[model samples]
Target: MSAHVPQICVMGVSAAGKSTVGIALAETLAVPFVDADSLHLESNRTKMAAGTPLTDDDRWPWLDAVGAEYAQAGASGLVMACSALKRVYRDRIRAAAPGVVFVHLGGPRELLLERATARTDHFMPSSLLDSQLDTLEPLGDDELGVAVTVDRTPAMLVSEIIERLRA
Candidate 1:
């Protein structure tokens, strides 16, 4: 039988270091890394760049695209970075990839806002941080994943994630 290949989504609100931790985790696990932001339509990116929060209608297609990536990863597995702030969104991804696990990175709003404000290259604006925070639904007890506090270095965070995932 083939070895089990892990599919992981590193999720959280904006500026919670989803991309950074996802990248590090992918490297450590020897999997392909995908930043789900890259799957957003240009129109959605434009709306977010203007500091407008996306409506649920605006996000459905993008969320499906993220799910498609997970489905396409197949035996190769994948590590994805996405702001899966709502339970429905995570459920959407799970529908596409049943074996996928989530790693939720959570931190204080102040720290998230501070990090969002410091970013220069991302399309998301600090103004939308509150919206993201308001929309966040943490992982449930029955979910196949772990919620981690983002209070340490990326290396440290990745280590903790690895340990917890193995547990």
Candidate 2:
């Protein structure tokens, strides 16, 4: 790995195991972990809890806050889990914290749905999965990130990410 540890954003639709993998990755990298959902405005959380999807306006401030958190981490480095579902959203985050790398977690819809259904206490309900998947734009070829399949255990996923980063 480089002398400077990369600030990583674990991104995907809800239930793609971003938080699970991100926490393990942060442990491995010895960096702090933040969940963007925890930073959401109460209004956004209310809407999501009611099964309504947020518009771009609703997301801008939240994304900016997430980006700012990354910028704040600076050389200390951070691993954040966010449903950065669009290219524009990722671009917005990149604009705030340049050189941020995204780890895109992906899996089949059935698996995602199963995970979503199995979760408890999360603000994002299973009903929002389709909307999230609909909005997701896969990482571009030029994007600074790796797409990892989410069919394995969180430890294995973290190991894969660590190996890739080290290489």
Candidate 3:
């Protein structure tokens, strides 16, 4: 691991293991971990719970909040799990925390749906998986990030992320 603590965003569609991998990665990196879903307004959560997808307007404030968290972390660094499903959203966060690096967790639709369905605690419904997937824009070549398949265990994924980030 590098001597410098990293500010990282674990991004993906719902149930793509962003939170799981993010938590482990933070622990390994000795930084704080936050799930960006916690930053959502109750109205947004209610909308998602009702199987409604959020419009861009509904997300702007929430994304700004997530970005603020990253900005607040400063040099201490932070690991955040956020469904930054679009390049614009990622850009918004980057504007706030310029050094933030995203780690995109990607997987097949079947696996994503299965995991989304299995999770009973989240507000986001499995019905919204397709919408999130539809909105997702993979990390571009110009982006400071890496894309990793989520077929492996969280430990393996975190290790890979650590290695990639280090390199």
Compared with the true structure, all predictions reach lDDT values of 0.92, 0.93, 0.94
1-167 per-residue lDDT for model 3 (tens digits): 35677899999999999999999999998999999999999999999999999999999999999989999999899999999999999999988988889999999999999999999998899999999999999999999989999999999999898888788
In lDDT terms, which candidate is top? 3
Q: Tell me the spans in candidate 1 whose CA falls farther than 4 Å from its real position.
A: 1-3
Model 2 agreement with the true structure over 1-167: per-residue lDDT tens digits: 46697799999999999888999999988999999999999999999999999999999999999999999999999999998999999999999998789999999999999999999978889999999999999999998888999999999999888788678
Tens digits of per-residue lDDT for model 1 on 31-55?
Answer: 9999999999999999999989999
On a 0 to 100 scale, what is the lDDT of residue 166 in model 1?
84
| Model 2 error, position 19 (Å) | 1.0
- Per-model TM values vs. the true structure: 0.96, 0.97, 0.97
For model 1, the local distance difference test gives 0.92
What is model 3's C-alpha RMSD?
1.1
Give candidate 1's error at residue 52 in angstroms.
0.7
Count of backbone clashes for each model? 0, 0, 0
Candidate 3 runs further than 4 Å off: 1-3
